[model samples]
Target: MSSLLEITWTDPVTSRKGYVVIDTLVRGLASGGLRLRDGCTLDEVRGLAQGMTRKESLVYDPADRYLPLGGGKGGIDIDPGDPEAPEVLRRFLAAVRPIVKEQWNTGEDFGLRQETLDKVAADLGLASTVEAVFAILPDADAARQRLAEAFAVNVDGLCLADLVGGYGVAQACLVTAERMGLDHERVTAVVQGFGSIGGAVARYLAAAGVRVIAVADRDGLIRNDAGLDVELLLGARDGLGVIDRAVLRPGDRTGPREAWLDVPCDLLVPAAMSYVITEADTSRITARVVVEGANMPTLPEAEAALVTRGIPVVPDFLANVMTNAWWWWIVFGDIEPTAASSYSKIDSTMRRLVEAVSVEADRTGRTLRACALQLARRNAEAVTERAGVTG
Candidate 1:
């Protein structure tokens, strides 16, 4: 069910090749992030969608308003640095326009800018990641209130924050650290990737007193035993999360590709791309815990190795469900919550959910991935079955 669509598109202007992948759909809706990267493939999109599926169903509060949504992911294979990026985006939107809608909503991932999403909206479309896709629309609340007055279904102005996903991941890490009895203020963490998600995780953890010892960006890996300053690093990074090595303190640079996997720390967060951590990387994984910040960052074999080695690996779907809660509020909350209120709500709930997940994983002696999957599917199926009953 991972691959629902694999379409190859030829640009009408440049005759360049492009692709789109729809991983899965549920109840006529499918949604996930759309990434642009060199060598990106349908298989990678499919795997990411699978995690999104789990995320859509991994309910923390289980209120009556929530329901599991289908998972869908999209990606385009292209040089992200192409000068004709606008044309590329236009072509992509045109190609995907026919198939994307209430049934298929997509949003930004790596190598994509918010302007691209604006382009999509200009074409009369929406973006749905783990949260309500309508949040990106103009005046989301007015649209919703108008629809409510009309007794209609209009999701105008449903919106999401850029850091919602990363915020959830940080909370998950904190929960894991707390459950393991690790001192949060003294935790040594290595974060791979400096984009929105990675930067947010680093900032959240660093603010909470975790020492971010290593940060691997597009340019290179930077390390500081005294803990790299997350704020300083964020200030020095580019939009793509590439670090300005020149801004670093002396003797704090790991340079490019210098064994990021073997760095000893209390936490290792793979927030970059998929398959970054594989079976071979396990032997080098010295962290007490690994919290996924990216979809499918760890291969099955690598996860198995961690489980066998008794290291708790917080699965991606479980660790990154912040947007799901937000979506629930967007569609189901009695009243709309402000950005700050929504984040505060998600943060507190995320910690509790992760704690529950960790406790259950220990009780079942299974990986966080397994526990999350079992619970998500179980809950989704139950709701599905209930809806099918005759009145």
Candidate 2:
């Protein structure tokens, strides 16, 4: 029951392609991240936009109600290494100028960053920053300012990318573990991917006394039964999330970068790229719980196998609800995000969401992913009903 609209524009002069895929527009507005990657395609944009719809609308209901925002995604297909990248982006932006004001809004994603997008957004003659391109309209800007006012900060101070998804993943792991009756203070976990989201989650989990027994980055996988020193590994990690093999100690175990799948622990977090887990990985997935920290990390066959084996595959849609929750709260309520309180808010909300879904899953004897999909589907129904759009 996913919905979408695909818009593609190609600059004749630059030969660069731009895309806007709106999964469904609630109240005539759609929003999501804008990604930049080489070889980007329309199908990929549609998939991401659909994920965005699920992420924003799913409220763990029949657990709770929520404000439904339709999902949209933007993609610019061009290599960043090209010397004419800026010019190419300008041309692409111009191609979509009309719709950028009316139909869709976007923020940075994948190869893009909010700071860089904000700095360069002016060239596109757009009021929205690349971080939050769709929020340029007066209503959206006023809403952001209200969020700022709640936090007693300036309008320009808010940045959703700081810790939203990463923090939620860690919090959900802890809460999910507890819901399974693993009430101990120190739960062990193995994480794949060592970059921004992965690193942030690992750091937070380690600090919270979760034994991060193994870590995988682009360079290789490192394991320690007694738990790796997250701080030390963080220091050794490169920009690409690659940890140097030389940083390993004498007794530590090392394997291929993808060997993280074989590590035994109470929790497994796939925080890297999509579809890392396939049918082949099911045999090696020893962890009791698989918390998806990335979009579509587990393939269909692998997911079914895990669920059939009594393993809980927490879907990305439910695990990464912090950002959407934050946005919903600020716009619907008075709470504004602040440096000091944002972490606490994300932690509490994530714990609540994970617990709710876990409870429902336990009661219904269903996989966590199934429970999430149920909630997302129901929420989509609510949106369609309220918006008076015939399904």
Candidate 3:
């Protein structure tokens, strides 16, 4: 059965409606983020909440069992780019702060940042303001530190791998190459997003000797078989993650956005928005491996088609959960973070997760998705039992 969920809120200050979706809760606690986007829907928030709960349970050692931590997600349907959007968000939080303090812990997500979270906490006059802000804000410094600590214990000294989801994608590509008995050094990669996450992955792959041949962002796509300069391209990128078109020669660009998928490469990393790889574009993907850096970048049908073509995909939730886990531990446990500690934790968790899924899939002759789901379910069950919850 699907989990029971709830949504409620109202912003008297901005008159915006805020929706919080709680998928499950254990011991009166649930964790998730507040996403502000132009068209975020309640249904979308619900799905995200469920994903968080599963991810949290999986990474925190389900065998220790605890009632579900209850996953909750909140969002406001407004473009955060607007000048007054922050005020709108503040009002929204003010309306929901009472409920949030009691049960639903919210954090930063899409279009939300640490500064915004801090502002909201200050508006409410909370003590240990930074700590309180971190409690409900995703990826806050405190959250990151906690994650670093957990990851440090998990992997011991390999901090480079856990920087972000993009690093995870790079690791996945490495794992895929090793499994296929291909030369990792010769592999070429195409990244669909040039944001921090995507850029990090590209840089990591380049540093590791893989050729990153193509990169595309909201502005347009740039291709160079000779390999584009990661540092140069990053210099041209704006705060919104769009690459500046003026930096590239006209001939180096392509049109119609979707042309990015047609570029030939050994690996494709979709680090942009969700559902970018649809059924129509699935057949055009020439990459040997598709590692998602964003949540649900490929629809179920597209994933199935790719699998049918014998292409291996690392599931988004599995590949990207390390970041979520890191933040959760940071805020919940009050840990201090260092760059070395954070990177090591991300690297170890990603490596073990990719290797485990690969081994399970090979042993059972099942898809990576199937193996991942089975593992997630098993972990969830163990955690539930440890929490002494049965139904």
Native-to-model Cα distance after best TM-score fit, residue 110 in candidate 2, in Å: 2.5
Q: Which regions in candidate 1 have their CA more than 4 angstroms from the true location? A: 2-6, 12-19, 64-66, 123-160, 324-328, 331-337, 386-391
What is the Cα-based lDDT of residue 110 in candidate 2?
Answer: 59
Each model's total of backbone clashes = 5, 2, 18
Stretches of model 3 off by over 4 angstroms after superposition: 8-17, 62-68, 126-163, 249-254, 331-336, 389-391
User: In candidate 3, residue 189 scores what lDDT?
Assistant: 89
* Reference-based lDDT, residue 257, model 1: 55
| TM of each candidate vs. truth | 0.86, 0.83, 0.83
Candidate 1 lDDT, 13-83, residue by residue in tens: 76555666655555556667677777777677767777777787676345544455667777777667777
* Candidate 2 off by > 4 Å: 9-18, 37-39, 60-66, 76-91, 130-142, 146-160, 236-239, 244-254, 331-334, 384-391
* Candidate 3 lDDT tens digits, 288-373: 98888776789889999999998888887777675566554355543235555555666666777778889999999999878987
How would you order the candidates by lDDT, starting with the best?
A: 2, 1, 3
* TM-score leader: 1
Positional deviation of 270 in candidate 3, in angstroms?
1.3
lDDT of 2 by residue, 218-336 (tens): 67789998988887887777645678777778768888988899888999999876678998889888888999887778988999999888787989888766655655555544344
Query: What is the C-alpha local distance difference test score of candidate 2?
Result: 0.72
